[model samples]
Target: MNGEGKVVCVTGGSGYIASWIVKLLLLRGYAVKATVRDPNDQKKTDHLLALDGAKERLQLFKANLLEEGSFEHAIDGCEAVFHTASPVKPFAADPQAELIELAVKGTMNVLETCTKVPSVKRVILTSSIATVFCPKPPLGPNDLIDETVFSDPSVCEENKQWYLLSKTLAEDAARQFAKANKIDLVVINPGFVVGPILQPALNFSVDVIVDFINGKNTFNQRNHRFVDVRDVALAHVKTLETPSASGRYIIVGPATVTTNEIEKVLREFYPDLRIADESEEGTSPLNYKASVAEKVKSLGIELTPAETSLRDTVLSLKEKCLL
Candidate 1:
């Protein structure tokens, strides 16, 4: 069969990133069987169903991230399986119960199921940049934040960076499982992802942009590399198509921005936004790095600039009446 005719399964199909992956897969003429927690929820699954090729190419399955073998039926007869489901809340009521345990269990469940699926040749895992570095790391000029670096698990619990801990441990577990069971695995570690909202519900990353424009952020002090959600979606598809794409790839934009820069950019497009002026809040002094050249060259992908990412985000939010 041709590349476009292959069947692929994407876990957590209703999620922010997963939703876009499902859309692109169907657009590429690949049959998609998407797993969601509740396929019957029109509020959650309607956007995916409304896609152009969804009627003929997309299938929805009721699956749970923590349920063992829940993904097998959806993944059956697929050449590739994309595992994008994970706990992403920055602050959890109970760190272990809400984030840590679920992340590891979900990763294990998906990888185990892949082992049993002989038809699955490749597994693309949607991990985050949180796995590559501590949530709060000491940065210096030219100190690279790339695939080679890993988060320090020892301090995440104390620092309240449970999200990082969850991703780091889960990715480590996946690598080990793939080695032992002989499963082909590739990891995509994307930075603070922001872009047009394709789903009915807002993702945590885009929610920050909404809050920024609406004057919800009272104080700001953090640095991040923003990547377009659309670009990230394409990256996942490219990884699946490229035969040489293996190991972990860090997906991110070209700029490192502070909260003030974000506000200024948003204000450029949304003059009526209530975002507070942080002119006095000088830009963060840290020169944090994201080593993306190698990955971009390898994938032959062009990244959208920060302005495009933020601009489309605001437009999408307004279009969706989210703002």
Candidate 2:
């Protein structure tokens, strides 16, 4: 096993992506100290506790992102820290305070705790593609975005794109803190992550697929960049295990997809479901833009196929009675 009985801590362990990370960590022979908002809440932590090696290796800790020193105990004596806890609330009355400030403060708190914990060797911060490209540049049809491109805070703030603003600022804060403190930090920036979710609740990304299946008219964007949740989780683990892995890696499918592509696959597999038609809204022609960076290729992470990801997502939703 690659983990070799090492100890690591994962913040926001119950989240859709974090839970899968915990599962993979355990399977690879690592003892995991996972943090949740409330340890006593079985609803949130139960899935984590039921992993293959949970009884022997997994420990749940209560921690908060905004509260300073909250992650100290959870991060103490750990080999690495996977700081995946970030606020996903998109519709908040105070975007600055609720989303932006909270995301930045939470990241700082985790990094501060890592500095206090001497055993912490590397920090794998989960970032998003929102930080890679800005809405202002208005991606040209021929443009290919990579890790070098950064989201402009001014652009995000001016447009009231609070979610992107939060991710952008939070990632910047993590990089600055890690550099000043001499911590080995590697960031995984994933795109439109959608796969069989390990967590019980429906995440915003998965909900996008759910809404489409239920015939709800959502999603302003025409092209949806999809990546498997498992692939994203594997990228995090691989980045930590591979000593040479550094900097940001964009984890997404090789090609971008649209709702029509997704709908076609869904309808082919599931004829009974009521899938939304893109023609209903008179969507533009299929513009499969949004390419990923070459950094992910260096990690040796083969992304899952879009059709396989979509099928597994719906199947998992059905199993959980959430579809």
Candidate 3:
């Protein structure tokens, strides 16, 4: 359906990617019902309200991913819903249970609410490339994963990899439910999102970038599938409007790069920054170890170069005093 004049509910609207989605929706003349965990948090909603067209088109609602029917009020009268809320943590004590429950249950809850709302036609879910690519080597010299590849939850479960398992199951459940209920669902699976962070609140994912710029030794590995935040957000809006778009769309930048490459660019761009050494032993910042060219090409999206993406991210962080 055309987004103009139709209300769209964006879950986790205060988040990094969701915030951009809200901004674009408002800019495109769509009424937005943004759902956040705490509606009273003026710091979060204030910036959105201050954006152009937000005053007349934006509405904030308090909702929780774990709560049943919490999204019903926000989704009412909306033609589409962007389910971008998911528990994203570096480590979790009960990763499997918490991530799985939140991902699967939260998706079910949102879709359940959509069923009740007659106006709802589409649900754009914010999935990740983690659901498609496994975090291991030997993906072959030229192996690039796409929407057709689904992460083997069994492998993830054996390794106690809760995050991957959670995403896999969540997207799977979303697809199954959408088919049964006849709801049009479009899923965008993005790689390590790198772009200008709009909010001052740093997410867990951004911490890695911060560490890289600070010259932390723990992240010198050369493995990751990076994507620009703007591209991911733009893909979300495009998928929502594109009639031919269906199923999963893997949104990633041109190609993968190592942490060493990332650090070199940062050091070159900002010479004064505390750059990390390659000798330092630490976890790799690169999340998805696969290619996303096919999925992006299918959507006719041209990914931003890794150099440009990293440069923009560092510049943005410097401007915000995050560096």
Candidate 4:
């Protein structure tokens, strides 16, 4: 797992978490083949190139998750593959089918390509905490979820259900395939990923942060596990090197807080900024039940607190002029 001369292909190089993965890989001295939907887009690649060490080690390649053999070229000679490219849209027109297709097919495509190449040793999948817990209330006060717990797709129906279903099916597909093919797979199930936005664009998760900062919602009772994107990226890197880091790891922060709590922190830090009141009517974007401290810590990961993580996120957004 020496990254000095290793080649790593990061799917969805322009994405929020994937970009961080690519940056960390480059920093670790790995020659990166970043797969984008379109490598010709200068705007996207420009920001990546601006990062230190990216100029020499980074290589952008155009590959679609849906297309067969699309990732084959990008993955050639790669020793490790970070599959962080999965649909995050909460409300897709066909959430189940579309998510399933991308998650299962895309993973299969990556693994198939790995089989074609001799260098690939491991694949780190960016799964979500949603894959480990459901939106509904757990049975007991101590009903904390772990890597063993999986989101039940049968319970998923529409709208929000689609995203969860997709994650569940996709992760399940990966596990099944890994067992069958004996592919070295390490799954990192992170909670609501909150961190400084790498790109100027607002990604799917950032909509919640934007809504809170823009005074869009008013209720504050909901709570869920949250984690810093930087920490999650670090976990991916650690899992890559840790040969024993097989199976699933729940990458969550030290604490869970509601949107209202986050808003209060933002208002306190930036008094001039207008913030939203806690909302009571709308559905929560979080799954507050999942708690996998024992499991994640087993991998030697100490999560940052939610307050610290959210504060950093807000500061980052403000610095980037997004606030």
Q: Which ten residues in a row have the lowest lDDT in candidate 3?
A: 280-289
Counted clashes in each candidate structure: 0, 0, 4, 5
The lDDT per prediction is: 0.83, 0.85, 0.80, 0.77
Score every model by TM-score: 0.92, 0.94, 0.90, 0.90
RMSD after CA superposition, every candidate: 2.7, 2.5, 2.9, 2.7
Error of 1 at 145 (Å): 2.2
Q: Flag the better candidate by lDDT, 3 or 4.
A: 3
Better of 1 and 4 by TM-score: 1
Evaluated at residue 72, the lDDT of candidate 2 is 88
lDDT of 2 at 272: 68
- Residue pairs in steric clash, candidate 4? 218-277, 218-278, 218-279, 219-278, 219-279
Give lDDT tens digits, candidate 2, residues 17-107. 9999999999999999999999999889889999999999999999988899999888988999999999885568999888888899999
lDDT of 3 at 123: 93
* Model 3 residue 149 distance off true place after TM-score fit, in angstroms: 0.7
For model 3 the TM-score comes to: 0.90
Q: Pick the candidate with the highest TM-score.
A: 2
Q: List the residue pairs that clash in candidate 2.
A: none
Q: Tens digits of per-residue lDDT for model 4 on 5-117? A: 88889998889999888888888888999899888888677778777678888988999888989998899988889999888877767754677788778877887787788
